[model samples]
Target: MPPAEKTAWDLARAATHANLPLLGTPMSQVVDRLLSARIRQNAFKVRPATRAGVMVSGGGYQGKTETVCEIAAVFEDSWRELHGSHPETVPGSRDLWAPVAYVQTPVTAKPKSTCKAILDFYGAPTKGMDLPELIRQVAASLNDHGTKVLVLDDITRLRMHRADDQDTLDLIRAFMSMHVTLVLVGVDIPGSGLLREGRGRGGKSVNGWEPTQTERRFDLVELDRFRYDTDEQITAWTTHLAGIENALRLLDARPGMLTEGRMPEYLFARTNGVVGLLERLIEDGSTEAIVTGTERLTEPLLDSLPLTLADSVGRDVAAGEVPALPAASRQPGTRPGRRRNTSFDDRGSAASTA
Candidate 1:
């Protein structure tokens, strides 16, 4: 007899399997761009004019958080794999090499708290140091490590009032002036203010180089959920699902049992094209398959499971409807609290919510 068809339980077991690598989605392309730019920047450290940075912005669970880990791993792993020990020299210069430093910006991040996080990351002694002194110490410590890159994740958490945010920006500007390549990742970033045209708080009347300074240092990259109705988006979504199916085959007891077709479409409908939601839906569906002894993930099996969080929003977005803009614009002229923003936090790190 031909082999039995695989059950929902089988796929569920596979979904929960450990060490799953990232599926190659649009976000992967953004990750590549970030790494490539960093490599180029690090390779020509002598040319301060050529020094630059990048910002990765996207909706929540659109892979902003995961991208942080992946980018850090790429920088550190690539260097370590190439050379067995910590780099003794900077990429382009004959200076000591310190690797990339990744820090989660504290919630409502103030300048002092942000600096403290940076200092702690470097193990720099900050005892009794004033803000100015702390900046000097942090810079010196990073310099000693020969650190070439500074990645500030969860940047959305920074307070947006002029006084509060200006301080944080000052710290970041200090790092950029040192020619350190900075990578900022967040979901709340609006394409305005320093991100669009350089203007500080209060409006067009305000003139400052700080916003310009930020724009000059970093280029922008965006990542969001795939759209359900668009053919192009559907192709990408199917492509992602195909990868998962291929991976499942490795553990599949029966060959040709996990073929793809309608499943991905159902998944897109359920997840409304959000990658994170898609993953969660699959996991939940698989778990039920195990519990109920359903053998395979069919339309009925998935429909019986709880709906993904993005179900409604994803569908609307796929149909070309834009969600309400965040109120935290960070643009100089925008009204306070009118600036739309999204939540961001570093994985497994303490945040300064105060």
Candidate 2:
């Protein structure tokens, strides 16, 4: 039904579907396992050694930041549970206990700017403070607030060519020296010059330049796109689609609307197996389905919806051509045939020839 025809209740349900919570995937599971283990181990250690950190790196729309943030939030929830929800405050001090501090690396990030971002998270003042003072304040705040995990998102913005950016990177490395677990989220971190050692005076190479201490202490993990080349990969991809299908609320949407027949292949072609792009496609398709009275996701309906510029350019580069979806296999009951050729028939033919 069109918007004009939709009852108020129908419109309300559509809105709910549009804002569904983040669906779990295999990639998220891996990240959750690794990050959660690191945070848990760091929590128990009483030693003064610098705690290790995690760096989540991936291409655009891979949900690196969301996944890490969600994990950090989970850790905070448990940490607060173990400790009391409210701690006692001194007569002159504020009663603030933040187990997790999340901040974005400024676009024009410097050492002072980075420190200010962390202090800002704690609502601490940084006015008229120099670099050293700001750094000291940041450490003090972390200690006072009992912060166990600090997430620095969009860390790739700090390119290493400039002196300020190099100092910003060093400042982040110093954060690792504290007891807190530092989580850095960025795009293409390996190529972002973050892992490399800084240059000496006049941009000259330092003697025996090697991987920075930050790189050594931080374990880099990638949130990769879904793959469909093998049986296991295909199963994982289809399982992910099923989770999305289960979450959708369209009246006419059937169980296998997204996972059945060529729909899976078509969605993969459209989204290149990126979860963010897949969610966008589904969200838009669901809205159109609700509006046009179709109430179901069909290939034609999805194709008619305009492609996001990123998805369009990425699909073009990856597939090289528009993939053709079989018209007959679009129905919910239909199943796509095996992608691999049958070896039994080939063997029979070879035996006959012999």
Top-scoring candidate (TM-score): 2
Per-residue lDDT tens digits of candidate 2, residues 5-96? 66786778677777767877888888899999999899777798899999988776777878998888898899888876534334577658
Report the lDDT tens digits of candidate 1 across residue range 1-354. 233445554544565543245776876686677666675457457765535777777765666667666766677766666667544444655434567788887766677788888889877777888888888877776767766677887675544455677677667766776657777877646532435332434222144334455666677777777765555765787778766655542322233222354455456555556666666666666566555756456667766666545443422232122333222112332222233233453467677899
Candidates in order have lDDT scores of: 0.61, 0.78
Angstrom error of the Cα, residue 62, model 2: value is 0.8
Ten residues in sequence with the least summed lDDT for candidate 1: 326-335
Give per-residue lDDT, candidate 1, residue 349. Answer: 62
Instruction: State candidate 2's TM-score.
Output: 0.81
Q: What is the model-wide C-alpha lDDT for candidate 1? A: 0.61
